[model samples]
Target chain A: MRSFIKLASVALAGLFSAQSWALNIFACEPEWGSLAKELAPEATIYSATTAYQDPHYIEARPSLVAKARKADMLVCTGAEMEVGWLPVLLRQAGNPRIQADQPGHLMAAEQVERLEVLQKVTRSMGDVHAGGNPHVHLDPHRLLQIAEVLRDRLMVVDAENSHHYRQRFVDFAARWALAIEQWEQQAAPLKGLQYVAYHKNFSYFAEWLGLQRLATLEPKPGVPPSAKHVQKLHNLLEGQSVLAVLTTAAQPTKNAERLARKLNSPAVVLPFSPGAEGAEDLYSLFQISIDRLLAAR
Target chain B: MKNISVWMAASAAVAFSSVADAQNRGRISSTEFNPAISLILDAGLAIYDNDEDYEIAGFPLGGEAGVAEEGFAINEIELVGSADVDDKFYGKITLGIHQDEGETELDIEEAFFQTTALPHGFTVKGGKFFSELGYLNVHHKHAWDFADAPLVYRALLGRQFNDTGLQARWIAPTETFLEVGAEWARGDAFPTGGSPQDGRGSAVLFAHIGGDIGASNSWQLGVSHLQADDVVTELGGHSHGGGDAPDNEFLGDVTISGVDFVYKWAPNGNAKQRNLKIQAEYFVREMDGEFEFEDAANAESGDGNIVADQTGWYVQAVYQFVPRWRVGLRYDQLDSDNQFSNVSFTGFGSADDLIEESGWADEDVKPARSTIMFDYSNSEFSRLRLQYSTEDSRHPGEEKDQQIFLQYVYSLGSHGAHRF
Candidate 1:
């Protein structure tokens, strides 16, 4: 019986020797999923956050539990953004591979330049964030760093496939840089234009495209703008020059209409996500949002 | 054709904005477009014991069809739609359908325009709206954590619904905080009288301020007050109860007035992942009116002077040991006084208002209720919840009891943003 078991083990080992599987990645956000797909084309991959929904309100279900239990590497948007559900998921996945302080566990927010970091935070504030906005994927200059950071982690998991992962990383990096140049040139025409935004979420994109964020529509953080505030904005418009009003996928529209009409400005929705509003892919998400912004102006 | 012209106008505007160095600079052309609309339909039937008859919130539900399921009932079918007008504004509409064994009902829930634009980090919003009180209230049936509203809500809100309001929310430039200003409905209420009812309505003014306390934390605090005139149900027949029951068995003129405070908090972080959230509310009310007594010996009193205090709160805590599995526990309770002093009405023989002057049923009463839910979350969009609840009705003594509930929520939607 011992000899038979040994023979079976050897055969199984031999079967996997050629492909040499490196790692299986479970990503909470689509950006990390994209990076993993680039670095390890052969590995199993699952992304919890879709391009369409808000990343903060993911529902926890059973199949996801089964997936987490088996994940070899887990990547997420930390900095309190995914705090809403990721912690619960991790505790339930119960896999030692991606538990905190483990090699396979990661909070992508810690891997890049953070914006909107607050000095002090308190619960009295409606959903205040401390480590800055976790929506860092919007910055292409940082996308390379995200990919590089992901590559290092993948390397440790599948040391045998290090070279393969490295090669994949280089190819993707080249393509990404090429795309950057193309996007910059295409967007140059609309640079330096002033626009109004409803929620502050699009600041990162605005910076990248050189759009001037003249003003925000929110009268108070988390507070809906009042009729009085809208009128105040109209008054502010008399002196401030702006092309249009901008907002995201889920913005309530009453205030926007008043502002748009008051200033004789058009309203536009830029893809607030990489591809969430349905432009097909990350590339299209950018193209789509920009197209709408310019179009609405 | 109207939409096409609008699209054309938008394209012309974009070309005008980006003419800095384009070959088609200011050409009034070169725009790719897609205008899509989305609709969400929510409907449900509830099986519970309640008496809407002879009451503003409950009377309509009970008196209309006599409770479809032995107090079990079908409440509403609401279809809400939003079509994007441009970047920051969208048009909204809500259509509602109600059902009872005897009659089917229809009404409009909300119809208005919504926007997300303000001068300084403000998201200005205006529209006929439902108040954003609890998590469940904001979402319709399919999205609820459970099939029914918690008992505390029903007891306090009269009806577990609120519609008609305007608000302005601002996300500080720092992006970690929010402040809100809201105005209550000018004229609207549950059990809306199809015909203009005689009585002055009420309005509420609300102020809310809140934000994240830490890296992964968030909370909100709000205060509101309402100015209510009097709620009067004119008796069509001789009655002697809450509203002059048939043959004089009605009560009269209940003035509604209240002051309330709400607070919520959730602590979050990286090292010791203890996810905890808690919310609490307190309400004070005084009802001034007259009531008819069931027993002739019992006389009505003008100083029925009703004074009461009610409170509700919930505490939920969860810990994530690893990705994909989570266990959570939540406890909530509502304690209130159901019985007010009896009323005194003059001119006997029990006609409308006359008979109601004499008060008090066979039993003495005080009611208090509570519920606890233990939940297990498996992923971002699914969970199984085990819940236990208890309530004490008007009779208070034997009517108070407990119950156990189990439910599952499975949702399918695209990803959403994190901060707000």
Candidate 2:
């Protein structure tokens, strides 16, 4: 009986060790965090955004640093979007898992189709980019691509869990594909729905959802709209019925309200991220944006 | 001075931190600790060769004031730590200590607490806080466009940053994210007086939302609004409040409003291609009081009551000519009418305010400056900058002064190089 008890104890120790050695994954932005959660429900998840903040300015908090310090995998958005602080976070996390060029580290952009390719890049074009556009996740195809990238990374950290990650990704993709079809069907009637937005951030979504590309609320990409620009937008859309003014939830509604009043339109606030106001999850975020955008009409 | 108090606190904290490290040393060897600490000590020697001698801060000063090399004089010690209080709260502090001009000053740079973990992504911080207003404002002195701050920042924000308050920031749940924060503080913005504000309150509300456009390219756009009231508004006026607002007689009723916009893009991260960043700000002010500008032609009690608007913008381009080497140039300009209040320099018989108000080619006594700078970043930790600046002030001879400063930065305490 005593010998039997010792065997059981040894087996229990091995079990505990296996659990402790689970693959460590670090997803940099919120969507990736949620996707990682969906892929590995039991794995420890470290996310930064919840429902109401900007991902670009997420503090590389100490807790994040501590998490990075031990991470065996790092996943993040690239395109210099995280440039202000991600480099510092990765360097300080003391974990070499996600260092650039490492197999364990991956930037989501490499997996997606680039848009808005700049033929001429110069200072004359206030803040020109060397790469095309970086906001790829607005397109589900890009997110699917990112999922594949993430799946490969998981495979690297836990060869045993590789099958599980791929399986999870497949399942997620099937559901995602179905959702995309639903979105297309729902947005079919809303094709060419005209609106003005505070930022060009929603362009990919607008394109995917079949929303018309009207004019931006801002005069330039990042610059505020002057009265003259507002007048110009009005002039350009003279023949079209601009149903509403749209902006992200994080944006102030002042300028949108002003423009909406001029056009006799309703000012609408859409969640740019999953879990922001109307967006409760990544899957529902796009659906709701397209659905509500049409409903607002 | 508050600087002395912060230094004392930092020293004590460092000593305490060492104790904690010694206890943790059992898990890790001291060999790992040595390199971690060396990041805290760096020194430099710079020689100043200004065309003229000057006095700043009402002190007996001269034009040529070059001391150490353009970077870290010595010992840029920083202690980064996080603490858990009970199960409900957690706090982080990044305290820095440096010896500048032989004074051991302490910067309680960043300290904040989170109510929850990364899941909620909500946090609140109170203490001497750093304003995330502009990119450069948030960059430590160790990382900057020049050895010193930009001219607009120094003149408008007073050398460092907006401080003396609590700020809360949160992130949204999406692949592309949005950030928003609000801050409240007691401080004077521009035109420093004999003392900083006492018991006055102001607020800054800001938000940034943008996303990745596609592969190899990413973009972000941000906007911030700052409003300050009941601030000590003494600019040789019987002035009242803060930024680009209108002029007043007693200045006790001016509200300064400032707005900022920023955009940045880089391919394959912020490197492997040219990276460009553009930032602009406009400040407008309004007052409820009458203006008593004795210098005004009208001489009306509310003569300076007219609102004043000012703007500043810079387009900087950085192209990595080769691996590990970058050359960049930035052109910055600021223009304002009634830059401060309706206070006229000739009225004060010193045209200094007039010189400071008008753009480069505007007022006879107007003072304005524009600069083009080229920077050479040796590595993540060191940089050398050569800037040629031209000041076309309302004042004839004092309008222009130019210099090239070599600034080098050495990081101590394990701060990592940032990548986009």
Which model scores highest in lDDT?
Answer: 2
Stretches of candidate 1 off by over 4 Å are A1-297, B1-78, B96-99, B102-107, B121-124, B132-146, B165-178, B190-201, B230-275, B289-366, B374-386, B404-420
Question: By DockQ, who's the top model here?
Answer: 2
- lDDT by residue (B1-420, candidate 2, tens digit) is 113354345435532343243234222121233322224333344433443422122111111121233333553556655444333444556677866556788867666654432223455666665676655566656655445555445434544454656777665544444667887766543422112345445677776555444423445555666665434343333111123322322243344445555455444232322455555554433333322333224322223333434444455555555433555555555444543335433343344443232211123233345556566643344455655555442234542545455444555333433422
**For residues A144-241, what per-residue lDDT tens digits would candidate 2 score against the true structure?**
76776666556555655557877898898899889888878888888877778876667677777667667788665445566787777777767678
lDDT tens string, model 1, B14-33? 32222222222111110111
DockQ score of each predicted structure, in the order shown:
0.02, 0.03
Worst 10 residues of 1 chain B by lDDT: B25-34
TM-score of chain A of each: 0.82, 0.85
**Candidate 1, A1-297: lDDT as tens digits:** 999999999988877863576466888876677667778878777776555445665534334444565577887867667766665565434455666544466666666667666666543444446666667777777667767767766666565566787899999899889888988887787788888877566667777889887777876334446688888888888656677787655455568877988787787765565444666555676667766766765
Query: How far off is each candidate at the interface, as Cα RMSD in Å?
Result: 22.3, 18.4
Q: How many steric overlaps does candidate 1 have? A: 116
